[model samples]
Target: MGLLSGRRRPHAARRSIRALLAATLTAGLLAATGPAVWASERPAAARTEAAVAAPGDDWLRTEGNKIVDANGDEVWLTGANWFGFNATERVFHGLWSGNITDITKSMASRGINIVRVPISTQLLLEWKNGQAAVPSGVNAYANPEIAGKTSLEVFDHWLALCEQYGIKVMLDVHSAEADNSGHIHPVWWKGTITSEDFYTAWEWVTARYKSDDTLVAMDVKNEPHGTASTSPRAKWDGSTDQENFKHVCETAGKRMLAINPNLLVLCEGIEIYPKSGVSWTSTTPTDYHSTWWGGNLRGVRDHPVDLGTHNDQLVYSPHDYGPLVHQQPWFTGDWNRTTLERDVWDPNWLYLHKENKAPLLIGEWGGFLDGGPNEKWMTALRDLIVEHRIHQTFWCLNPNSGDTGGLLLGDWKSWDEEKYALLKPALWQHEGKFVSLDHQVPLGGVGSSTGISLSEVYDGPTDPEDTQAPTAPTALASTAKTSNSVSLSWTASTDNVRVAAYDVYRGTTKVNAALVTGTTYTDTGLSPSTAYSYTVRARDASGNVSAPSAALKVTTESSGTPSGAVKVRYKNNDASATDNAIRPSLQVVNTGSSAVKLDGVALRYYFTRDGSASVSAWCDYAAVDCAQVKLRVVPLTTAVSGADAYLEVTFAGGSLAAGGSTGDLQLRMSKADWSNFNEANDYSRTTSTAYTDAPAIPAYTGTALAWGTPPT
Candidate 1:
């Protein structure tokens, strides 16, 4: 049955003699007189129950109240947005069947419960002039390059699949050609059907889904264009456009009620005055572009004749975006606590709810453009939705390769783990329908926007203290020996909350630090036969640290060389002892068998003045810091054949090797910064080792091989 309208029945038959006698008896019974009763004492009850149950798919009209299951329990709709359900020619088309099912089921497991199906009227009726065939494929979008399948056929199949997954579907007519909403409109809506055109289309789809409980409400028009003053006067005819909407809506609502009055009727919001025009910047009106909320839609405050019914069985749908408020001039220019609450958000709510007397269902609001998903905005939006009991369907679910708008990609064959991780918790759920304290704030408060706030929602796992497992108390380390340095590695600890990073503690203090992107970590720089206890701790994104992992006792193998001496000498036949003063030459020799890693290297040299050692220059060589800089792979198993040491030299005002001279020289490393190449646990260089001799500068006798900045 269509939403708002209840089922109708055939004419009732009346009895003759028996009916007459019953009427006579009823009259006598009233004459017998009744006990005095207070009119105010009349028991109260809801007219809601006796009314034919509303269709389960009418999510918008119900406000926060959800359709109940057979058990009479509220059922929240948690599903993906199928914005790609248009013609096959569309690039972001979503493929259906097993793959979509698999992806959706995964979503279901993650707590998703409903699907918002976006379809273009043009695809359904325009292609075949209103008659079409359905396409077939394991992937809907993957239907072979055949043309026979019509949009109607495609939708029928789509609905069937939704049934298989036991998910409710909301068929949204994204656009209308006559008014030019957003999606391509069918030719029928392009000034073809007259005043009854919209109703006719509604009847066609509604009648088709009459018996399908899974079919939800229908949206009249996506985002109606033009306002009263700005719109053409003829377009505002009493029998068409706004007027026609009321006429068609009531008539269709009645017809739908005859079938099933349970269906919900959804209406999209208009762009009010002064709203951040970010979402509509490209298509904003030229002269009468809206700047006030209630002033735009005259009929809303005045209840124009076109708004079928009293706005009781209706839902108000609006769209919001972050860049509109955060980056645009409308909102950001005069941004203040008062402006955010009253000028920005409150007016929209007042019109949709107070004036219209309908619950709002945010049809589309998401991260888009280069703005991406702003967690701050998302949180605020969520809180506002929850506050008003407004339902919402994120603008898209597929990877929006064009303008930003998807939580996932359309490929459907694979999954994006990181994206999923970032979005999973932020996903709106059927449970906890109300805005929690963490996500709300009073108007004019110290928050992003007054009346709602989305900041600091993720404060780490608060409930279930065992969320993140603590690091082990004991330390376990595995060591490897090399001619220059000893390398050690260890395992990471378990945790309930996600581990942000790991710290490697030598003896009692942390010597190496690495981010916990994966499992293993390696430590360089060690003395033979030296025993050390390395502890690891798991930290959260908020900087909350967990107990240290078990200490792993490791002992390095002794080498023949002295504990911490490193010498540099010149190599190559063209080099000489005096080259140290001219071009400079040196080599690092580790006499010790235990492998050693110099976290950083620095050098002090003299350019012998009158046979006296004098300081000429100094240098520090180190790695550059990057967001994920801690991620690196330093080979600890280098062969003694010159591969054991990492070497490089830098000069000021360009390099002498480049025919330029006079510069400081030094060697530098992360000072035991753990690169997350291996598991977070690894050995670290403890003792400071230095090489006094400087390396010989390469001769620039020949053409330079495209010299550039050195890798920090």
Candidate 2:
């Protein structure tokens, strides 16, 4: 893509080719752009683009990774991209000759029930500033209906056509500017167009269409891309920087949703992601795995987009293309679906669907080379999409797309019969009729008999109703207490349906502003020495709440001395939550006035056994000797959040002299089954590689707690 087709920017040199090809349409009109076979595979009747008096309440939300309607019925969005609004044309291409009415209806009748319209932020801003669009891009003699209308008006007209034909609309901010080759630029902002401008443009448009159910989604940005060595390159990260695509998408998506809560927010991935052991600092080519622009989603494994309360409205849209666009490395060898899924799709984007992280839409995928490797890749992806019910939008409707030719032939009136044949199986169909995302409206509306609405296909919800509640959380107990706060935890609850949330209660009043999704919770803002009681209840997706668990009462520690003289410093040998073994090196310093006997001291390293109860340990080395150290894993009698078990360390031989130190006692712990541990929430676990004070790892002198805070 010298990364071509990704930004679709001379280096989108590909756009020059597309621009030149599109320019020729001004002369030949008919001779240069004709379908291979001018056969009508379409339904007998054509639908008109008349405005609909009643638009369906067809807004959708996600369940697990499936897109479900208001009635909880699953619906697939089989769509195609109609470019030009994002380009210099400032409106849909092929409008010069093809009637927008005919094309929009043709899509609904032929199974393309949704359209992803690419538009630039600059054009939206121009419309926002009341700038009139020039009519040069529109051939008034050929299609006079929208002749004198502004670009915004033309888009509104298209939205009306979609509503009448039962085709949903999704707007994509393809670039910061209105230039034909704007995608070539990497980030969302450029020169005069700030990121705020990009966001405000969306707010204005969303406010305009808030009542219209026709436009259901907004692709936060087109293809945020650039290499590690390139400037203005987009990176997928947790940072709030301008170059961080994740933050930008979240910021923009949240802003749009604030205006229209029903809109599906599509966040696309960036072009490149750092490989294992590599950071953005590494400029070497091998340090990263590059994908088609907006296609690499590996960063999601670690830094997922946090929509907070609006997570159900989030969808991940990744764009993929065939080798004909750019022969990426995966295409180098003989590759099939299995290989591609393993090497490319799974790591890049497919995992989101598989892991139920989010809904995924292949925002761009289609090309002209239907004979060889390109078609092979396309065919494989099509199968995956059909089998998994993943949402998608094929690349172009205009043949002007340089790398991936249009789904329609150059003439723009006829569909590429061969390509449509391959894609037909992936479309949402019931019996012989294609399905519409709308509930009441039939696809192609009243004129065509080829399609059915979401209700017509399902008739009722396909999934069984979830009425059962999750089990109450078990073994709720206080983990730690401070002068001002108290931390609590419990065993995870089981649910017949997904456990949507955990509600924590102080006495009888709910203390959390939002439902807690995890087992651990820390309640702060309390009076020192005051008594408190806490309980937790689990809730399922259907709004059923389980009975509250047994309550635990405790009094906060009064303001006093800073605990004991025996202090502990620990270094995490491995910080991965899924690591096979936890290796934490412990060092104990004796700050007491007299010598402390090793046999009388005990250090508890709190962690989670993670389901495997049978545990073992190894004393890699000790200050005295490896044989002198004894390690025992003990599950907590009353489970507290983050820490379900503790590794008790006792010395068999060795005594700490006054003002003496135990150099380094390297220890390792693991379950007998060798299953992984989730150390992320462990109270004593630290991500720091260097040794630091571990107040969470409580120490004791005989029966008295000596150091740090222990679970009450």
Candidate 3:
């Protein structure tokens, strides 16, 4: 049953009956098809954005090929599967190793909009019959948050957490019993658990949460598959409700919908299908088409699950895996996306989506990082999902998915960054930020750096379109600096409905291609020691933008070696308030044992050029003769917060030995008109008459630099 070997996968059903049983018994079968801000209330005036859990009417239904919210805005259910309630554990699998609350919050922050929780019919019936147990599977030390609760209570607590984080859930019937390897069975009903028990399980949970919309979906059953000549197998035909998957789906779907009409019912495909004119009575393997379990949907063309009054609630879900799970015939030789879609997927289940018969969700699709055919197959499926905007809950978030290693690594806390990067584009995102299913809270709760809410997506309710623009952001500041990036933060802007996102600007050009949904943004891909000015503007879903905020100036750190040979010092030569000329002196002192002798070493002083008068500079005095000193006045291409120009000073032929100083290299500057200049807010201005360390005056050495010159 381990995912490492294909022999134990679903394809074993294609072998001799004895081999098939061996594979089933040893196989841990699944997927070959499968599929914070706590309780704060909304403020009186929603105009001002607050990081709180607001309870908005969260109900969803389906249009032709899209799952829409109450306002009929298309929303994507991009998420992952967390299996455990269906297994012998009864609780989540990782609760033994990770904190349940932390795990839930982490998922929401990582753009998981919905969670497909695999559960067993036996477990639900147990809860109904008051057989709830404090699952011994959990390690209490790791999950102190729900240490004393029963498995049922833990699930309830998780639902509350989902509401707080703006995530949704879909209950999937993974198997008939609570056995660890129960998914290997071919039929929904096994042993004492009858098919009626399955229907009753869905009914009980549906009624329990009829008023709560967080549990918005119900997957009728896990993969149902069986080959010909296999008795007590799940069969699909355009006939009565014996073992026909279509009839069972219709029956269970109707029963669940009766309790709460807003729920989405997902129906999966079975194993083998009658080919062309072949009948179900045929026992010949060649007479039928065999695909991955729960992946053969050819029967949908003939016998579709009909929900008379609740047709909109039906969504056809199919599970597809890579070669590692079980390499079907089409996986060999030069296979590509075009071939796979046309040969395997088109006839199986993708047709339902292509023809707009119903909305499709690829309930399970993932595999190990084989870097071979498996990755190739996963890439093709991921591309299809992204191109068509198909809804999906990835195979798993757990790292223990045997054949298909999960999105999370073995540690459970650390994520498989590569796999997540591959899946990110398929998640529902707007303006570069992940989108949530809840209309009130954004994904990942309030103040999340990663997502926005459904109301932010479609401008709130349909009664009136959002027309009010968000308020201008305030208190913009650069919080952190790196050689190639700057992190910024500001107060949140308020909108009538919700602020969709924000736009960051450098000079006049928009630096961020997509709008930022959070209050913080780290602008990257910048040059070292570069001075940049930034501003921010708030935007609403209606495309209304607020006025720009006050600009903030930041200079990146130098990407160079440490300055050990010399240190630059400065002193204001004159502090006269009414002076027509400004004077300053800078001297490079050699601190290290080696002499500071290089043509590249220089010092720079920054100041604003007042009026249009041309400026002049000269070396007034130097320990070395003025002939060896050099000075230049340069105008800036972009004016920052307080300065627009800088004065550069350098020495040509002097070697300041260790513990020596280029003493008192004085300089002076003034406009041609002799206009008095104010240096109150100049970036390099200093009032201290005595010489001290001056980091403000950038100094440059041969291999090391400190803000003086632009990067080459």
Candidate 4:
């Protein structure tokens, strides 16, 4: 599912007799009842600043269902989610809009005492292996000081800024992939990642921040739920060891506690079975269900996870969503706070808190704030939090959530004042003590240091004389080759100070973002049956890059299946035009054995633009048939001042048979707008998958043609 589709909810049960009966009974209740009034008004705040402990003193631990300081005073977590480390981008989202320090300061001003950051295990492994890059464009432009730093180093920078701003952090292992889809694996381990690796990730993270008091806890795995009937290993069984939530939590939690006992172990519930009077058997009917990821805690009542020595530190965290995500049965038919609490809240996981079994943290909860059913749901949820004094974090502080938009909107610079106004009254620390209307007090104060500085933690060089580049690696050779990946090894390079890392490039495109420190590197995610050329460059601690090593080329094995493919060739059509412009032509061909149909094809062209230049428009000069193609052009920024643009031409419902071509489609650009076109620079092409026979495009080459004059 696309990220903009909103958070995916639990799969609805198939229509059956039981479902029909439940719907009929619900409708009957609505017909028999008159209009009812729910306590939708905001509940009065129960505790104030005097009731809570001072911010940022000692490490925190759970004391009888409550988080308390070393002095034993209560500490409430009122924060918002800033997701991204778990996303495909692998960095915080709004860094492009503002600095990390400034963003944290802004959150502090809003009475947010904590920040819940979601991350993925794969990203952690990449960072640990020194293969994570701090993506280019916006991220690089905004954080220029740490432009080439590894992802882990960038994460540390953000943590340092959080510590500087007096904000606590709860790390959430959101997914296995950097993308949004991995959260529903039923267990923390998925695909190439193993259960042992999952545990090891926690161990690494705990050890890294073991002494950092600002990082309070680890929110285990985000929303462990799938088919919960024991088939795919998602059942809540305490006795079983394989794929059991209790077993995994106890194992990982004990290890983490051993490393940092002060850290809280936040365990969430699974969405499975056990309705009302039903027994705890695998087949028991589960009437009530959790709406969001890692939300269904109904099983906690029967089998509360045993965290061993860290049991007291266990916090039962669950996520709740509004009608926008999914309208549970209780949400319909004379629904009010009473029905919602009885049908959905109590049976799911609220009973644990109501029975004083554990401290409850609403790990995530927020919606569009569109002032209707969503508004009412927010009000009721807020009432419960205020009345129960529960620890809470809003779904996000980002503007990227397609479901629950953010507390900040528009250019990401301005606050969603409406949300701030709604949430401020419920904050544990209001506008005076820990937070203020004017300025923020750094967590331990302005000069207080945690002994962990950027230089102390990061591997990048801190001195000036290390500017010399490392010697270029020698004898680069392909050790192994596969259809989708190539493994290469080369003689290590030496530098004046030390060779920090090596970069592997496929043609002119850098394939790996994280520096390769080892003599060997494996490049994955390649096209089958394609020839690829590689070069390696070494860099020193001071960011000096060496010249590329000798090139090594290899061809990957084929799939053996007859498939269609698209190949694009570029040529300088004209350069002597009177408008001081250059005309480029693209020849697309069906290079594969099968017929290929295309809805569209796009090319990302890179060049150096003149100072203070801008693209007025892209003009179509010629094509095989101009009437059969619709052309669109968009300008993009590849670097701080570089000109990057993509030209997309959509075909008018056509297909190119085997060895056929799109003839020549020509485009014109003003030389006054762009100069120094880097034809040698790697360009990108994307083929349309709209047709069943649209095979993946094989890799093509871009040539650097001489630029003197147009050919006669």
The best candidate by TM-score is 3
Q: Rate the local accuracy (lDDT) of all candidates.
A: 0.38, 0.75, 0.75, 0.60
Model 2 clash tally, residue pairs: 6
Q: Can you give the TM-score per candidate against the true fold?
A: 0.43, 0.58, 0.59, 0.53
- The 10-residue segment of model 1 with minimum total lDDT is 34-43
Give per-residue CA lDDT, model 4, range 1-712, as digits (tens): 1111111111131113213322422222212111011100111121111122222333677665566555343456778899878888788787776566657767875667778999998887786676867564236665564567656766766665565455678999888767766665667777898878888888988887776666888998888776435455455666665557766777888999999988888988776644445444444233323344576787777778887767878998888888887765445423346445654677677776655578889989887877888877887887777655688889888888887888888566788988777776566542133431101233332432321111111111134454445588899998755555677999887553477667788898655422355788777557789999999887654444677899999887575522224555666554332334545566667766666555433333434333345443353754557666655444331221232443434455577787987776666655455544433332331222222221221221111011111101
1-712, model 3: which lDDT tens digit per residue?
A: 1221211122232123223322322121110100001001121133234332223356778876667666444677899999999998899888888887788888899899999999999999999999999998777898776777788888887877787677899999999999989989988999999989999999999988877777899999899988887876777876775689999999999999999998999999988887667788888775677788888888988888898899999999999998899867666544567547855788799877755678898889998877899989988899888766788999999898888888887777888999998888888886677888876567887767787766555442221344445688889998756576677998887552466667787787555422366788877557778999999887665445677889999988677623345677888888784567779888788765667674556676888777678788888888787888877766543345456677867667768788988888889999889898888777887888999878778775532343333311
Error of 4 at 165 (Å): 0.8
> Root-mean-square deviation of each candidate, in angstroms?
24.8, 19.0, 26.1, 30.3
TM-score of 3: 0.59
As for candidate 4, its clashing pairs are 87-178, 166-443, 223-294
RMSD of 4: 30.3
- How many clashes (backbone atoms < 3 Å, residues ≥3 apart in a chain or on different chains) does model 3 have? 3
Q: How far in Å is the alpha carbon of 364 misplaced in model 1?
A: 0.4
Cα lDDT tens digits for candidate 1, 269-330: 44432222222223333322242211233234333323344233455555555653335322
Query: lDDT (0-100) at residue 459 of candidate 1?
Result: 20
Cα displacement (angstroms), candidate 1, residue 193, comes to 6.5
Q: Which portions of model 4 show Cα errors greater than 4 Å? A: 1-57, 228-233, 275-292, 430-712
